[model samples]
Target: MSNSKLYKGSLTTIILKLLNEHDKMYGYEITQKVKELTKGELKITEGALYPALHKLEAEGLLDVEVAKVDNRLRKYYKLTETGTKETVNKLEELAEYIKTMQALVNPKLA
Candidate 1:
């Protein structure tokens, strides 16, 4: 969902999952990639994105690399060893959560 509140809890998991798939990415790139994948249905705003990145970095699940691109510094993030492990755990948790939601949302099929 593009609505930030709806996806707030899972932002870290989404970020980690993306990093797991793509090696490394900067903030804007992550937002763009998410939007592209979701076909513009989901947009990660600056206000929501930076704090989450900082939090993940604080948690030791992410590593940051800064590079000078043109005249600006672009910071890229990748999963740490624990982060890689965490990606698998978080993904499993997310999958289970989605399954539960699906079942709840469609009890007849469940």
Candidate 2:
């Protein structure tokens, strides 16, 4: 998320997709999950993550549920009705983007 443009625009889509698969997720959990999935190649920094989450929440694409867990209130996020549909659209768009990049980078592979 630092300087790679590919990872920049896809942060929200990634969050949405993860929420689409899971019931809900807290901030650190999301970051750790991304790291585990990517095998440490990609990292979601706090500086980038919170603002994006706030933006999505502001946009009505996400719902928050706060609960006390082990003496700490964890704010979990999940997709809204609109976010569910938006996740599908964003996934399709990302898939198309990957396809296009493949075609451009390696004509034979695409």
Candidate 3:
């Protein structure tokens, strides 16, 4: 699948889960973390990532903190209380989705 297609439905959950694990993260950090976690199977681009981050912040699921890091202002994202709860639900949902897809793709083996 195209990287965009691969991440299509799961980007938000990935972001939320990463933030939940790390407590806080910046854009590049998020991108790199996904790459590391997926062993480069998934790549999050700045184009896809910034818009989603902005939307999540607008939706109140994330809180942004600005700090000067290495002489540049970086925006860090952390889960709000609502985001934490939402992450749990999203993870459960994603787990079910993976199971369903696996069954479809490998029913005989399963």
Candidate 4:
């Protein structure tokens, strides 16, 4: 989560947004993609990532598929129908949050 506590709250939203962009992704791939996207500024730990993924799966927002690759079973996650819709809603909410924070942090000069 880098050096900021801010990323913790948005972890689930981040996962959903990534899943929304790609068809499906495994755990490691997701982590690498995040690091790549953030240019190593943000790092998602396994401890944090797995729980969020489980929670999303439990909530019926995500579906998982297990496949054997190189004698190891890997779980791939993809958004459910509800998840796809939720992604859009979550993104909108995040956008609004950013806008509010920007207003507070960089208020217009009067």
- Candidate 1 residues lying further than 4 Å off, grouped into runs, are none
How well is each residue in 1-110 modelled by candidate 1, as lDDT tens digits? 63668788889998999999999999999999999999988888889899999998999999999999999999999999999999999999999998899899998876
Whole-model lDDT values for every prediction: 0.92, 0.94, 0.91, 0.93
Better of 2 and 3 by lDDT: 2
Model with the higher TM-score, candidate 2 or 3:
2
- Residue 90 shift from truth in candidate 3, angstroms: 0.7
Per-residue lDDT over 1-110 for candidate 4, one digit per residue giving the tens place of the 0 to 100 score: 44658888889999999999998999999999999999989999889999999999999999999999999999999999999999999999999899899889888821
**Superposed model 3: Cα runs more than 4 Å off:** 1-3
Task: Give the TM-score (vs. native) of candidate 4.
Answer: 0.94
Each model's TM-score, in the order given? 0.93, 0.95, 0.92, 0.94
Candidate closer to the true structure by TM-score (higher is better), 1 or 3: 1
- The best candidate by TM-score is 2
Clashes of each: 0, 0, 0, 0
For model 1, what is the alpha-carbon lDDT of residue 43? 86
Candidate 4's C-alpha lDDT?
0.93
Show the lowest summed lDDT stretch of 10 residues, model 2: 1-10
Query: Lowest-scoring 10 consecutive residues by lDDT in candidate 4?
Result: 1-10
Candidate 1 residue-wise lDDT at 49: 91
